[model samples]
Target: MIRLRTVEGDPPDVDALVGMYADFEADDRAQGIPPIGTDLIRGWLTGLEGIHVVADHRGEPVGHAVLVPVDGETLELAIFVHPDYQGATIGTRTLGELLDCGAAADATAVELHVERSNDAAIALYRKYGFTAEETRSMELRMRRPLVTPPVA
Candidate 1:
């Protein structure tokens, strides 16, 4: 069974999450993400300053979703599901839990950039209400608004 939980109050399962990314194939990369090195992985995780969630199956991480603070009020969103666990409901659950926490944290909006060729990911983001704000080359920048905007 897959279980999803927020990474909080502790160091988090960094190794397990790293293992998931390390297992990724070249085709699974998104705009050159999940960078290819232990140092890079650790550095990326260490720099996160917002909500993060992980999906675990039998104590091994199979998916991860995070919302990192950017431009003060906006958060940058990212979600990854290990190839072995793709097509299951893990990504949806992980993203849902992270967004729930982000909302409670008063997130005004969250943004993500995904490759245009990745229809599956685009559909998933759209299902969560992310709309395109810009498109450059092969990447689309999408934003999901959580709170109402103030008057001009």
Candidate 2:
């Protein structure tokens, strides 16, 4: 069974998460993420401040999703699932739960940039209501509204 847990303002098993990245092949990377080494991975992980959700399988973290604040009230989304764990519908569950997490935190909306050629990722985002707003440097910038407009 897969379990999703929120990691907000809390430290997670950084090593396991980083290891998942290391296991990814060159072709599996999106936007040059997961870095390359332990130090770079740790650096990237440490630099973010926002909501994180991890998918635990049995005892190890098999996937990760994060929502980092971009502009005030808007968050940028990113998700990575270990290569071995891909195609099991884990990405669907992880991202869906993260959106729930975002709504709980009162996020105005969530945005993500995915590789233009990554149809699978784009489809996943589209499945959750993210619309492609623009394309820049081979990446598609997508956004999904999470909160209602305040009474004006």
TM-score of each: 0.91, 0.93
What is candidate 2's CA lDDT for residue 82?
A: 90
Determine which window of 10 residues in candidate 1 has minimal summed lDDT: 7-16
Per-residue alpha-carbon lDDT of candidate 1 for residues 14-121, written as tens digits (9 for 90 to 100)? 777777788888898887788888778776777665677888899898888888888877989888899998899887788788888888888899999999998988
Give candidate 1 misplaced runs (Cα > 4 Å): 9-11, 149-152
Candidate 2 per-residue lDDT over residues 1-94, each given as its tens digit: 9998888853378888877777878887877787888889888888867888889999898989888888888999998889888897888998
How far out, in Å, is residue 2 in model 1?
Answer: 0.7
- Model 2: CA > 4 A from native: 150-152
* lDDT of each candidate versus the true structure: 0.84, 0.87
| Candidate maximizing TM-score | 2
- CA shift of 102, model 2, Å: 1.0
Best by lDDT: 2
